[model samples]
Every structure is written in C-alpha cells, then in structure tokens.
Target: MASLLSLSTVVSHRILSLHPPPLNRSLLFVKPKLPFSRTVSRDLRMRLHSQTTNYGDKEHKPSSIDSKLNPLEGAGTKNLEKVVATILILAQVWSPLPLFGLDSAYISPAEAVLYSPDTKVPRSGELALRRAIPANPNMKTIQACHSTRLFTFWIPQRKPYGTMESNVKKALKVAIDDKDSILASIPADLRDKGSELYASLVDGKGGLQALIESIRYQDPDKVSIRLASSLDTVAEMELLQASGLSFLLPQQYLNYPRLAGRGTVEITIEKADGSTFQAESGGDQRKSATIQVVIDGYSAPLTAGNFAKLVTSGAYDGAKLNTVNQAVITEDGSGKVESVSVPLEVMPSGQFEPLYRTPLSVQDGELPVLPLSVYGAVAMAHSENSEEYSSPYQFFFYLYDKRNSGLGGLSFDEGQFSVFGYTTAGRDILGQIKTGDIIKSAKLIEGQDRLILPAQNNSSST
Candidate 1:
C-alpha cells in the first residue's frame, strides 16, 4: 500500500512537470488504453524504485522515507484541486453566454422564406396559372420584368406590411416607374390602347393616382376600395400585353387536334322551369343569357382544342347542366353524340410543355398552368373508364370557394383535371344555373384561324 501511494505521488509530479499547468488537467482525465496504461505503469514503477533506492541509501531508515512521501502526496493533491477549479470556472463563465447573447442568431420569417426550397409555391390561383404557361423566351423575360404583372402577381403572396397603404404604394411605384418596359410588352396593334391605359394609370381621375390621393387622406377603407380599382386597371393592361401560344407543340403529338392560340367560347343558358333568366349588371331580364369563356391553348392545347372543336360541332346544343358540390357539370353527351377522349394534360410550373396522361402532385409543390381554384374555372371531367384521360364531352365550371380550399388558397382538386379555360365574363350567372338548366347553344365566337387541324398540316406540307 505504501509503494502504491508513493507511486501515485511520483506519477502526478511527473505529469505536472512535463506538461505545463494548463495541459495537466487534460492529460490526467484522458483514459489511456490497456496496453498504454500497462506500459506507463511499468515505467513509473522503475522510476519510483530508483528514487526510493536513492532515498533509502542516504537515510537508511523507514521513518525518513515515510516523511518524504507524505510531503510529495500533499503537493500532488494541491495541484489536482487547482486544475479542477479552473475547469469549473470556465464552464460557469461560457455557459451563460449562449443563453443570453444568441438571440440574434434566430432567422426572421422573410429570411426563412427567401431561403426555402419551396419558394415557388404560389399563393393565388391566377399567379400559379400564369407562371405555368410556356411562352416564347422573349415573352417570358418580358413577363417577369413587367411592372403591372409583378404588382398583380406579387400582392397576393407578399409578406404583410404594417399597413395596406405601404403594400399598395410599393406595388404602384414599381408599376409607374417601368412605363417603357410595360409599353414594350403590348402587341404592336394594341400600343395605342396601352399608351392610353398608361396615361390613365398615372394621372386619370379614378386610376392609381386616385389611390395615392386616398392614401394621403389617411382613410384605410377608401384606400382599400381605390386599390382594388387601380389593380383592375393594372390587370387590364397586363392582359392586353400577354403573348398567346408562343411555343410550338411537340412533333409527336402534332396529329392530335390542337388550337395554336386563344379562342372565345360563348354558351347560352336557359332555365329548366322556362322562366326568364335574371339579368346581370341591371340589364333587362331575358329567357336566355350568354356567358363567355376565354379558352387558352398555350398551356393546354389538346384539351382546349378538343373543347373548342366540340363547341363548333354543336355537340352541346341541348345538353343538360347538373349541379354538384362546388361545380356545374355538363351531361356526358355519350348517347347523343360521339366524343373522343383526350389524354389528361397539365403543364407544370417552369416546364416547357404539358405532360400528357399525367396529373400534377400538388402536395409536392407542383402547380398547373390553368388552376381549377378560380371561381369560374372550366375543366374536363375524368374519363368514365380511366383517370388517365379526360371525358371528352363532359366539362364543369368550378365554383371555387376559399372556405373549401387547402393551403396556398388551392382547391382540393387544384392540379387533377385538364383546366382549359375560365369563365371570364358572366361568372355571376354560373351560380344561378340549376340542375336541369339547358345549354341552349354553344358557339366558338373567335380564333378559328388559330385552330391547327391535322389535315391542315398535311395539306400545307404537301
């Protein structure tokens, strides 16, 4: 026991002497491996024996040896205590700094959103649809830089400012400052109208200038109302400048019916009860009313083309309307007239062409060019036998209600169907139509020249 005690005293002294005070604590605590420990113990035993032998030779007495070892043990204990106290002081000083000084390390909401991988997630149906449209390279660049387009698209998705006035003023300033770029977006024939709208936006009586005036008055409600009016004008200017159907259809799918540009479809509705239809906008009541849907072929050429062709063929002349939850569906028209099924078509955002026979995964952040979340969205129904194709004769007008939508204001069926068009005019009439209402007539009012039939391509080639 005396030898063991003395050996520990000698080892501690050697550790303190070889490694300075600062490193002694670390060297002492590090658990040596089995072989290293055995070697170290053997070397320490030899050194201890040599020192003990020298002391014995000089003193020639056990009492002298005990006196010397006792002092060495005391010194080793004092050095260990000092090392432990230094470690404890460091722990106490640095631990509190993390709890007190790291508040600034947390990221802000804007920073979090900016760095998010899913930043392309759209907040509005219109914005989603617009982003999905595959256009000419020049047109896409112009659309991205257009002030009115940015203002209209950004307002719905931007982070909230303290006041709506700030949001409106910021968006308006962006739009007003880019007048030259905005004018360039307009078609050559529409530049005169575009210039007039620009003039109206800057200084007209009820334009965005009026919004600025309302903001100056410090009336939030007036600012809100005028902001809506100004945005409406901005939206009109954007529509006038949009380039339609600028990309070419894939060569393999060229044989299928395709509308190369935009088309206008007008449907006349009549009540089943033979009652006069309620007129919108204070117009006189009539037995029949007309609603116009502007069908886009750019994003959904095959689906929109099929729909336009059916309208031109008088397939829906006497079809019955059936009302389902949040939708107004047309009869299948299978027994009355033959219909050709088209592959399911959806153009994903940032993609060049529509993916045929595929449905977008909305949960995975895939959004369609024509979102079905709009109140008057028009989409083809799924084929009776297969979900991979659309029921050529049956279509529906979606009655989108935000109360029924999921996150980002998208409908439950946002990217599932082939949304060919929207009920641009007479959207109010959609809600009034009953289950037994008749589609008295459906006509393609415009864009026949833009229809590229399979035979027309063959004839041109020959």
Candidate 2:
C-alpha cells in the first residue's frame, strides 16, 4: 500500500481513500516514536492555510479523520511524511480547513481546542480524566483537576512524574507575564500539575478567546449616554489625536493597545479653518455648529477613554472631515481614504493578539452598547485592509438609521467599527456638515478623570 500511494496517485488520480499502514506501524499524528518525525511539515502547514479558503466544516469529521497511513522506510520517512502529507493531500483535494464548525484562520494549533470546550471527564474506559475549567475565566476560583484527553487529537506523552514541574512553572510565568498579563493570575498550586498548567492557560483564556467571544459581557459598572440624531454616510473616518490633525498625511504615529476599563465624558466638535458648508437648511447662509457627545464612561473604557482624552486635550482640533460618501461621514486626511499610515504595532515580547487598538465586542455573553445601527451613531473608523477593524484615531458618523433602511440590526459598520459615543446634541448641525470641514474645536468638557490615560504608548510599528 505504501508503494502504491504517491502524490500523483493520491491527488490527480482517484485512488481509494483510507490507506491503512502495516499493523505494527499503525500510527497517530500524535507523538511519534522518533523526535525528527514532525506531524506536519512547516511548508505544508503553511500551504494548507495558503490554499485554504473556508475553515469551519471543511476539515474531516473527527469520526472520519482516521489516522491510517503506510509505514515508510528511512528516506520515505524523511521525504514524504505519510500523516501530514495525507492530510495535506486530502486537504488539497477536499480542502478541509473547517473542522467542528470553526474557521480558525491562524497558525496556532490551540484555536480549535479553545473554541471547542468539552469539560466532560473520560471514564475508566475512556482516554483520560476530566479537569474542570473556570466558568468566568477571570474569576480566580477555578476547580483544579487534571484531565488528559479533551481537545487534543492524540494523547500527550506523560512526563516523568516530577521532572519538569518547576520548569513548566517558570515557562508559564514567562508566557503569562511576558505575553499576557491581562489573563487572570493563577495560584502556585495549579502550577504543579505537569503540562496541564500550560494547557489551561491557552485552552480557553488565551489569544483565541480574545478574538472570538461571540457572547459578550458587560462590565459591572455601566455608563449610559444620550446623543443627537441625524446623519450622512462616508467610508473613511478619522483617528483624533492629541495634536489634533496636523497634516492629512502624517508620516507615522505612535500605536497603543485600546484603553480598557470604564468611565464617562462629554465630547464637543467645533468648526475648523478652510471650512465650507451646505447646511441641511436649503443651502442657506454660513452655518456654525457645535456638536456635543456624551459617552458612557463605564462601557469600553479603553476605546471611550482614548477618544475622551483626545477631545479634552484638543488633539482633534483642526482635524478634517474629509470624506462624505452618500451619508457616511469619514474624516480622512487630505480628502484621501487612508489611515495615519503607522506600521503594524508589534509588542516587544512578540504577542500577536492585538496589533492595534480595537473596541471590545460580541463576546463573553453580551452585546455592544454603541452600534452604528441608528442615525447619529458615533464609532471609531478602522482599516478594511486587515481582519482587525481597530485603527488609530479614525472614527465617523452614520448619517441615517441603517436598520430602518432595511439592514436588520447589522449595519455595514456595526461589527467592524467600535461605537463609543453619539451626537448627544446638535443633530441639526450634522445635517449642515459637509466634507473638507475642519474640526475647529474638539473639547472634553466633562469626565476627565474617567478616562484612563494609557501609559504613553511605548509600542511602535517601526
């Protein structure tokens, strides 16, 4: 069977599936007998993603993923690894990236396990015992029992009883403090449980959850805001900064993580120089408008606070309202569609979860308080280039209620952008506004203390 299976025969030719290996050499993709035997080649794994379009439901069903392959000799083992190659072959033919209704499009193998949470412990006949995970992951009170067979494809090798306990603890501390201090801290006792410690850290409370918490949760404290209602539509938005907007084309700017925690503020938008107006009032006379925005300080502290601080500090002054496509109000620099042009933010310690600022959204059993589903909804403008919609100081105003216009509750900007504040007053001003208008003044009249001023952003995209 091993002799019969070749790349040409496996792919181009319709060879029968399920090539079981020799009875003794029957293997799992899990820990092979030799260390040199990697489950998947780096190139093939990347190709798997490069060629993959859809992820969820594209992978073979667990029941269908039978690990049967021909046992190979020396050179064959080195060249055509049967397990990953077979998977790649099947992946190329059937192209299964979608496994268990999940389309995890990253390089991390932990994604599937994190999303697929099954706490059921295996019985004596089963593969391994069950360990209970934390319900509210941040809650420090997690029941600590070690389970071996949960989301893994193959049973992990048991380390010698106490060989690497201290090493794992040190590694975990490094992974936690270095990569993510945001995760709830673990107690010392939990560190003693072999690789289970590492498993728990990444299983549910790691980078994967940061990306997908379809069920959102609200903070204990809540801040409700009221904004004026009226609108327009444009695709480009502005990222207001402390210096206001200097030139539409800033060479580079500092990048930071989103402001988190909760607070309040009043955002005021004023006119700027070189401003032209075609007021909603029948193209009447020169119109001067002051827009006041009240943001719920308690919700989405990082995003809301960042905006509020910029307003209070007068960084948004002189910013241009550059784009008004139909009804969307986008404040791009120089009337062009572009962000501040800062490179991708990379943490010094090599964390990839958040490359830039973004709003907390649909996850942990909750919904967003501010969504651009209605007229006068204010949200941060983000780049459409990357999977992340979080941008520096870009935000815009939706001129009309998209939901009433027949988009259901989902606005074109709803899930992607972060809605932090609204036009609490001066809705009529929004009507009079046109592109190329300068923000004469953007001030924060209240709730200065509520804003969490991030430690001057030390991270850079350079």
Top lDDT hit: 1
Estimated TM-score for each candidate: 0.59, 0.36
Q: Output the TM-score of candidate 1.
A: 0.59
In candidate 2, which residue ranges exceed 4 Å CA deviation?
1-286, 326-330, 333-367, 384-389, 402-409
User: Candidate 2's C-alpha lDDT?
Assistant: 0.34
Give the alpha carbon lDDT tens digit for every residue of 127-243 in model 1. 444554453333343334332333543354442333444545555566666667778878999999989877776677646567667756755566556555554555557656655
Tens-digit lDDT track for model 2 on 1-462?
Answer: 354334333321112222222221112111111111111221111110001122221222111222233334476553655454455445533432463222343213322221222222122111110111111222111111112101221224532223223322333344455332222333334323423433434343321222112112211111000000000000000010011211121122223323332223333344455454445556654535666665533233345655665566556667766433214343433223222322222111112122234332222212233444446656554433332433445566656432222112233233334555566566667765655566777666666644454456523211
| Model 2 weakest 10-residue run by lDDT | 226-235
lDDT per model vs. reference: 0.60, 0.34
